[model samples]
Target: MQTEKYRGYTLWGHAILQQEGIPQPAKFAGSGTVTRDTKVVEVSGVLDAFDSDEEAELVGLSWCRAWVDSHG
Candidate 1:
């Protein structure tokens, strides 16, 4: 998992590997959280699979940006 701070929001990227019937080598899951004084808001999502963690982290960042823009 990788975490990044952006625009007062904390964004994190989660990479999972599934070795079931079909192997999923790289799966990207994202979560974002923001604290406003005493309240906290959070969002999470699953993105398309990527070959690298960096790409997944980028998607997580984008999702966090959109979430903040819409929910902030």
Candidate 2:
């Protein structure tokens, strides 16, 4: 998991390891959360399947950033 502060909100990004039984390529699932002053603002379900943990984590963070921009 990774965390950052953006525009007075806290953003959390994570990568979920793919199970052994799952297909290849999409070896990680991306997700994220957004909070303001410890209060939950938004959370994302599995954003998408990614090729790597880093990719998933970045994607999740990007999603959260976009959310903040759009809602602003």
Off by over 4 Å in 2: 20-26
Model 1 residue 48 distance off true place after TM-score fit, in angstroms = 1.5
Tens digits of lDDT, candidate 1, 6-38: 677666656554334455464444444444443
lDDT of 2 by residue, 4-60 (tens): 999988999999998867454458899999999899899899998887898888988
- Clashing pairs for predicted structure model 2, backbone only: none
Q: Candidate 2's error at 67, in angstroms?
A: 0.5
Deviation from native of the Cα of residue 11 in model 2, angstroms: 0.5
Q: Each prediction's Cα lDDT score?
A: 0.60, 0.89
Best by the TM-score measure = 2
lDDT of 2: 0.89
What residue pairs clash in candidate 1, if any at all? none
Q: Give the RMSD in angstroms, all C-alphas superposed, for model 1.
A: 3.2
> After superposing candidate 1, which stretches have Cα over 4 Å from the reference?
20-40
Error of 1 at 21 (Å): 4.8
